[model samples]
Target chain A: MSVEAMLQTIKLLLPALMPSWRFFSVIAPSPRIEITLLKTAKDTPDSWQEFRPRPAHLSIGSMLKRMFYNARWNEALFLTSLAERLSSNPTEHSSQEILKRIKAELVRNSFDSFDSAATPHLQFRLVFVHREGEQLQKHVTFISPVYGSFGDTDS
Target chain B: MSLDYAIRLTEILLALAFIQQSIEHFRAPRDEQRLFIPRFILSILLLFGFQTQWVCLALVILALFILRRFQGPYNGGSDRMGLLVLCCLSLINFMPSSLWREYVFGYLAIQLVLSYFFSGWVKIKNPEWRNGQALRDVFQFSAYPVSEALRTWMNWPRLLVVMSWSVILFELLFPLSLMTPTTLIIGLVIASTFHLANACLFGFNRFFWIWMAAYPSILWLQQRIFIVEQL
Candidate 1:
């Protein structure tokens, strides 16, 4: 393989060699994940909940602890990057991985086990927070197909 | 700072970043996750400065797997910078020749310098960033604002514009600061404070730590490499 291609593979397999430093290249709408439980394909939905909600109050101790332990917040950033990736390149592997992980997490949160007999499904949409002001405005950007009852397979 | 001291700091600080990441991955309540135990142990080994070269090598491999687990960097530049520190420090440990070790550390310094330059280089070309609208928007609507209350900084337009240009100029001219020990120390402090401010504003604590870990290499190289070139 070419050196660039090899480097890309190694990056995935053994990372930390990235050379680019450009960040926040441009302003664009940011994404948030919202999901609703579905009993059937035709069911509208009972209610939608943000998959992860930022706490209204951030304690000083918790902020300090984030220096060494901010895993959940980092995961939210990871998911946001994946959503941006999905918007730019719909077929990207990272985008699909985001979908897969989100499906699994939602199922795990909703049901006790993977082997549970309940056949509930999950449908998620990307809510794009489009503008900044006294109040943040958001709109649904993309909706994934409804996931399986157990989230065992791709929807 | 001596190369040896710099390498030690790099290893320890990078170990902290690794420890921070490994904890979540190791016990994140997700069943599909793998390699829980060793990842945790190796991070501790790295932290304690056990077998330097071997531990770094093992962690590099695990880090790649961790990257695969996340499908990309788990935390963007912070993860990449953490890995870069890990990879370079391993090479520094394994390379027997003092000259080779110096060159590796110098390479990391050059990368660090170029990172700042390129960050400013790109922003200088962008109209919005130059005019402060981009940064204003960042504070206003970006996902990065740590909390809603912090977003109030966007209301101060003149301060936003001045802060934007200060960042641009500081970053763009940062390389010239390497010419002397005094300027280099000043630049490092500014750069570090900038990272700290970012961590405070955006809650990217890993960026602050990982970039701090990379600084010792630059410090060692500044005395040995960059200043020598200047002389």
Candidate 2:
């Protein structure tokens, strides 16, 4: 099928897949999410400058493709790692501490396997989005800036 | 090439691809592999290309509905493309004598071709893709990174531009290559090389084989439509 047609199909099905959208508003109405990592461009010398998913220029159909690909691994990895870290203290309020811990865990677990030469560091951030409803407020929280990079392993 | 040989060749490639993917899946953490193992096994069986029609059909359905669902979020393009190829294979197998089988295979070929075009079309329109930045970004620190040398390519914007255009042109013109047997062979070779590069550079090994498996269908359609029209 054409990409346009495929997207139309997805648009028709999105409502069914996410039935609770009507109950609350999205934090970012725009599909694109811009995130600034913890490190500056100078600190990272990776061949690939950015690690975020840039769907800003994509059509809805292409964006859907990115979403599918990201959800398959990237998003899942972040959420799983976060959940694991959060398991120890469910009431923790320090997003910064949690982010730091997540970054450390990723370094310990993922960096060596992905040993790329260009990226100097891994960075992450926390994003809290609130949905206001008639009777209650729903807050959805996730890591905003999570990226993987392969740096030159001198070894 | 003859349609018979073309189809057989595709079957071989498909079998190899799925078996490789299954092995990779098996190597992953148990939690990830558990649900996909059975489907991968069945796909490998179907790849043998000698299975009974009913058996192949059953395997395809099971892989699509049951095994694929179990794979959960991990499943994406590879699974979707694999399913497409398997469905086409099943349809072709179940109705070997039907005149409409050619159309079924044609549809598969068209979808594969469009997949390429759509990907390129999307990229060409995006400034990041056009400037070669997207390529750099993907190679740098994404899920599949091969080496540090890939980063140096960013320094040469001209090279990146040329490479980006090459890809876009290749994808857009891929369908035209199906106009003749010779062109179709050439097209398949080029397409195979592209997939091979993706596999070696990005670990998209599954895409390599699954896309290769679709080649025979394209060849079949070309021979069916263009050759007959020439006659």
Candidate 3:
């Protein structure tokens, strides 16, 4: 086989073989995920809460432990990538993937308002945040229509 | 470092890395979680030095599932480094000749060094990184900051500038450190500390272990070059 054909075959079989190593050079807007509970279109949605609040406080010992046991944080990074893609290109497959994942996450956790609405619904949005001086600034880049509070069942 | 010693260190470190990563994935929702099982098992096998050659080959095959699971590296550089180490170990273990194994180790060491150098080169070139704005933005805006408390570091503009320059210079001059054993050890220490600090501040714990897994390759390669010169 030609080298080009061989290379093409390898690429198909081993997708992870290609990698770009450039890291942490540029500072771009960071994506933050937020979700709100809503009862009706007319009902003002409850104030937005950060979807994955930085674990309240990772103590020094815990932080040290995380150096070896940090799959949770790695997942956070994965989610951030999904959020970034969703914010930048809402029509892409990753955006849909993130949306499904978010719905699944919300279903697995308790809603903020335990005072359940007759028919509770959740809507999530991607916010792109940047720091200017000491103040953190943010703007909502994308919002999903109200999703049913069930896995992959979001409208 | 002896090749035997380096290989042993790498196997253990990479094993710990895989186990930790699998533990994390184990927490994911049911559908997405089971994918790491084989990786977890192989990592255990690799750690114990059980059927190492066969285990390396299995892990190499399993890496495909990992990439497929995340569509790419779930965490880019760490996963990339992990895969590189995987491929290197697999090739070195299977290849019978010492010379070919040395070449594989060389490729890994060169890549490891260049990861730092190119990162520093790009940062130095960027106006934001040069002025410390990039570091400021990282502490201030990036999701990387492990805690809201870290943003307080943003108050010291001059300190940020000094730190930024320090990183740029260290990474840029890293290649020169390979000249002698003393410099190489110092360079590796500083580099590992840098990764450690990043792990603490950014919760990028995986990067710390995966990168460390590759360092023995650098030490091994350094010794090889000096021996070649002596010959």
Model 3, B183-210: lDDT tens digits are 9999999999999889998998888889
DockQ of each: 0.45, 0.05, 0.51
RMSD of 1: 4.2
TM-score of chain B of 2: 0.84
**Per-residue C-alpha lDDT of model 2 across residues A1-155, encoded as one tens digit per residue:** 57775565455333222222111011121111112322433353232222233222324443234321332233333343343334434333333333443444445653333333443444443332222332223232433333442332111
Write down the lDDT of every candidate, Cα atoms only.
0.76, 0.53, 0.80
lDDT by residue (B1-231, candidate 2, tens digit) is 565676667667766766655655554446546644765676666567557366467756455333322322233466567666766677778675756666667777788777777676666677767766656544433334333455455567787678878887887788788778899889889988887666444445566667778887777777778768978
Per-candidate TM-score, chain A? 0.71, 0.25, 0.72
Of models 2 and 3, which has the larger TM-score? 3
Off by over 4 Å in 2: A1-155, B1-5, B29-37, B65-75, B140-144
User: How much is A128 displaced in model 1, in angstroms?
Assistant: 3.5
- Provide chain B TM-scores across all predictions: 0.91, 0.84, 0.95
Off by over 4 Å in 3: A1-19, A40-46, A55-57, A89-93, A100-111, A114-119, A131-137, A151-154
Q: Which candidate is the best by lDDT?
A: 3
Q: Each candidate: RMSD to true structure? A: 4.2, 13.5, 3.6
Candidate 3 local Cα displacement, residue B146, angstroms: 1.0
Cα deviation at B108, candidate 1, in Å, is 0.6
How far in Å is the alpha carbon of A76 misplaced in model 1?
0.2
Give candidate 1's chain B TM-score. 0.91
